[model samples]
Target: MSRVLVTGAASGLGEALAAAFEARGDEVLRTDVSYEGGVETGASAPSSTHGTFRLDITSDDDWAAALAHVEATWGGLDVLVNNAGVAGGGRLDVATMDEWQWITEINLFGAVRGTRTFVPMLKRQRSGRIVNTASLAGLVHPAGMASYNASKAAVVALTETTGHELAAYGVTAHVVCPSYFRTNLTSSMRGADTELAGVVSHLVESSPISAADIAAAVLEGLDRGDELIVPDQPARDAHGLKQSDRATYDLVMRAQAAKLEGAPRG
Candidate 1:
């Protein structure tokens, strides 16, 4: 039985991950920013768990307090799932700086802060795992998701560096880059174009993959010790394209604008 801490566990993929771990007899510390209304964060299943704690990923104080709680309650963590993320989409030229900062702070820097806080504990234990939730947009740059893409790509890089730095200490780090899946991320996204947001929302809503599917894939990755995990076939394909052929990938992504009406003609 492992001690795990999963961020953004109120709902969606995070919730599913927490459930999955609990099912496997792991003690999970489930935390999320939205603890009050939209979704209940504290629900437990068949196994033991720490009731949801209010964790705003953007706050350093929150990270400190969370670590304190983990140290006090569970002593040390075996796995840290930095799964909290917010999506943003709009043309690079028109997207607001606030949107960029918001996405970066929540999606990219959140993982960084979590890693910085927990690496010491993991190193002390001499065995741990960090799973960062990135997106296919990070590996495969999309035309309208520059802010989101850049943030996730940085996470990918961070995870890679972490894998190298922590391997000797018996701590493993991995990045989960998934494509469109049904989740609340679409509803909460911040961006300039409502229509474009809707388009992405539609894609997620219509997608066959569910949050549960992603959670399962993530668990599989952890078990397999994958350094970089692409959760679905679409994400795998996208990552492969980017790795094998950059020019074709860019052209294909840029050509996506042709399908979206009113997207700035480039």
Candidate 2:
């Protein structure tokens, strides 16, 4: 069985992913930034997990401690799932620089810190997998989501580079670009006062799929050895449209942008 580590596991997709892996008999280290003070860093509490630790992805010390725990406890890790992120976006003219930094730090740099911390051990072992959770926004950029789009897109690029860079060491890297599904991700949404944020929240809340469904699809994708896994039909269709019919894609995107422009700002 694989020894897996998942960040942002307190709830939502990360929680579902940890459970999915554990259900398959893999030992999982479930972690979240919110799980602090009550549980010591690297210490497992009696939650629904093989182990649960408090890991603030923004902190390098947390990353170092996680690496140490894996080394001392599991000997090494087989899969590192960088799934921690926040939801935030606005128009280029509307989003503040600070808001962009906040989302980027957690959404993009969090994955980077996790990957950077674990690569040495994975390289030493000569076998490992890196799974990064991006978003459909990364692949198909919609209007008024420049910050979120850029962050997730960067994750896709990072995963691609990591895959190519570590291929010789038998390490595989994958990036999950899932469309919106029913999850608590919107709870962490920043700039809730904005119209764009409201639209994103509506889409997420109204999705037919659940976090478990996406988690299952992700596991299936991993089993199939997919490098870029777009786990939902709508996402696949959107991306396919973008590739096969750029003019149509442009029209659709521009239409959405036009709608956004016409709407009253919250």
Candidate 3:
């Protein structure tokens, strides 16, 4: 069975993914900053094959410590799931630099750091998988969530590049672009201004899938050696829109924004 290390496993999609892997008889090491009340109390905790640990994805020291522990305990890691992320939504013109950096740090840089530090261990194994949790926002631009959109976009690019780089080493990378899934990510979303609150709320209300479904898709993608896994219908459609016509996608998003925001006619 593969030994998997999942970051952000304390809650939400990460927690669900960890449980799913463990249920399938894979060795799972679940890590997240919130240890006491996060995944520790959820479905992830009761899984027979899962173990929990504390991990702060934004800290290099935390990453080092977690990896060391995994190496010592499991001997080596066969899969690394970079699933920790934060969400922020609002007008780009009003977004603060601090907000942008914070979102990028957890959503984009955290994945980069995890991949960088764990790639060597994976290479030592001579075969492994890296799964980065990118959002559908990465595939298509949506209004009022500029920071989250940009960070996830970066994740997609990073995953693609890393997959190419690690191919010769027998390491595979998968980027999961999931559409609105029912998770606490919406509750955790940070906003510097209240101007876009209604817009963000509307987006959250449009969620069509569950976190468990996304988690299942992630595992399936890994098994199939798929590079890009769009977990739900909305994600697939968003990706198609991106590939087919950029202008049309933008127009559609604008219309969605106007409808959600209840804006007056121009």
Candidate 4:
């Protein structure tokens, strides 16, 4: 069985992916900033094949420690899933500098650090996979989430570049662009203002996909060796919108915004 390490394993997609891997008899190491909480609750009922490690993705020292633990236990990692992220909800005009920095630190820089620190381990394996969780917001920018969109878009670019660089080493990279998966990521999102909060709440309510579905899609993508994994129907459509026509895509997004604003609230 393959050995895997997943970041942001406290909840949502990361937790789901870790559970899936463990269920398949793979050795899974789950990590998150929520050390006590995640260990006590996140993997409360995890399979026998799974273990937990407290990791702060933004810290190099934490990554080093986690890698050392993997070396001691699993010997080598076959998969590295950078699933940690923070959502920043706000309009471009009013977004704070601190919010922008914080979002990028976790969402973009965190992935970069994971990829960098784990590549040596993966290179030793010769045949390994790296999955970075991006989002549909990366492809089709929504009106009020500029910082989040930018960070995810950077993840897409980073994944593409890293995939090319690691190709010669027999390591593959995949970027998951999921649309509106049901998870705590939304509830924990930082809002710029009250107006942005309302807009974000509406978006979350309208999302049709779930974290479990996205996790399943990730495994399928890994099996297929897909470079970019758009997990759901909405994600597929959003990707198509990017490639079809720029003007048409903008018009469609504008229409969506209008409809969201007009829709009744409970």
Candidate 5:
């Protein structure tokens, strides 16, 4: 079985992914920020996970420890899933610098840190995969998701560049962009806009799909060797538009935003 490490594995999307990997018989290391309450685990967390460790994704020292642990236990890692993220609602005009930094530190830099940590091992193996979780907002740019959108968009770019750079080493990198799905990120989001929070929460809760579904899509994407994995249908459509049509895509999104109650008008 391949050795796999999944960040943010205590709950929600990360937990779902960890469970899926475990079920597939891979040796899984589930990592997350150790909360005062406990390590977050989803209802479907698998009993077969190899181990769980405390990992603050934004900290370089924590990532070093995680890699060291992997080296001690498994000798090498076959898959690294950079799935940890935090959402922050933003009204750009009024958003503070600290708000941007908070979101960027975890959402974008967290993935970059994970990728950088694992690349050496992956390159040595000459056969491994890296999956970075992004979002549909990265592609479509929803009105109120300024910080989140920017971070995820950066993840997309980072993953793509890694994929290209690692091609010669036979190590593949992928970015997963999923649309609205139930995730703990909603509860953990930081922002002052209650209305933005309410809207985001509504969209998340209203999603017919669960984190498990997104995990399944991710596995499928891995099997297919897709570099850019758009897990949900909405994300797939949005990504398709970005890939196929630029002008019409932005125009449509802007039109939709025009109807938003609090959105800025043209």
Candidate 6:
């Protein structure tokens, strides 16, 4: 069984992923900012059993502690799932610099920090996987989601880069770009536009698939060695259309933009 570490594991997709790994008999370290009593930036622990820990993804010190924790407890980590992120978005003109930075810090740089902290260990072992949770917005940019789209797209690019750069060391990287699904991701939603935020929430709540379904698809995709995992059918269809039919893709995108133009700003 592989040793796995998952961020944002208290609920939603992260929780599902941690449970899935445990179900497969893998040793799992579940973490989230919601938990308390994280070790100081440089504390040492001899060992720990499979369980949860407090991990604030945006904190460098927390990441350092996490790396140390893994070394002490598991000896090595086989899978690192960077799944912690906040939801934020708005029209480019409406989104403030603060909003952009807040979302980018956790959504994109959070993954970057985790990968940076653990890559050396992965390289030394010559076998490990990095799984970043991006979004369908990363691949197919929709209107009124400028900041979120940019952040997730960067994650996709980062994963692609790592996938190529780490191949020589037998380390593989993957980015999951799932569309709207039942998740508590909206709980951390932040934006200047309330209407847009509600729209996002509705989409998330109304999705046909659940977090467990997405987690299962992610695991299957990892087993298949797919670098880009689009787990949901809606996302798959949208991406396929973007690839195979430029005109239709443009029309769909523009139609959404038109609706946004018609809606009252919050």
Best by lDDT: 2
Residues 174-263, candidate 4: write the lDDT tens digits: 999988767888677774555666666676677787787889888988889999999899789878977988889889878866764554
Model 1 CA lDDT for position 258? 61
TM-score (C-alpha, index-matched) for candidate 6: 0.95
What would the per-residue lDDT of candidate 2 be over residues 73-154, giving only the tens digit for each residue? 8899999999999999888877889989999999999999999999999999999999999999999999988999999999
lDDT agreement with native, every candidate: 0.85, 0.91, 0.82, 0.82, 0.84, 0.91
Task: Please give, for residues 104-218, the per-residue lDDT of candidate 6 as tens digits.
Answer: 9999999999999999999999999999999999999999999999999999999999999999999999999999999999999987888889889999999899999999999
Q: Which candidate is the best by TM-score?
A: 2
Show where candidate 3 strays beyond 4 Å. Answer: 36-45, 48-50, 257-266
Compared with the true structure, what per-residue lDDT tens digits does model 3 show for residues 157-216? Answer: 999999999899999888999988778886777766565665566656777777898898
The collision pairs in model 1 are: none
Give the root-mean-square deviation of each candidate in angstroms.
2.9, 2.0, 3.3, 3.3, 3.3, 3.6
Error of 4 at 28 (Å): 0.7
User: Could you give me the TM-score of model 2 versus the true structure?
Assistant: 0.96
Residue 48 C-alpha lDDT in model 5: 39
| Candidate 3, pairs of clashing residues | 10-39, 90-144
Tens digits of per-residue lDDT, candidate 5, 69-103, equal: 89888889999999999888666665678989999
Superposition TM-score, candidate 3 onto the true structure: 0.90
Off by over 4 Å in 5: 35-46, 244-247, 261-266
TM-score of every model?
0.92, 0.96, 0.90, 0.90, 0.91, 0.95
Q: Could you tell me how far off, in angstroms, the CA of residue 144 lies in candidate 4 after the best superposition?
A: 1.6
Model 2 scores worst on lDDT over the 10 consecutive residues at 38-47
* Residue 247 C-alpha lDDT in model 6: 96
**Per-residue lDDT of 219 in model 2:** 99
lDDT of 1 at 24: 88
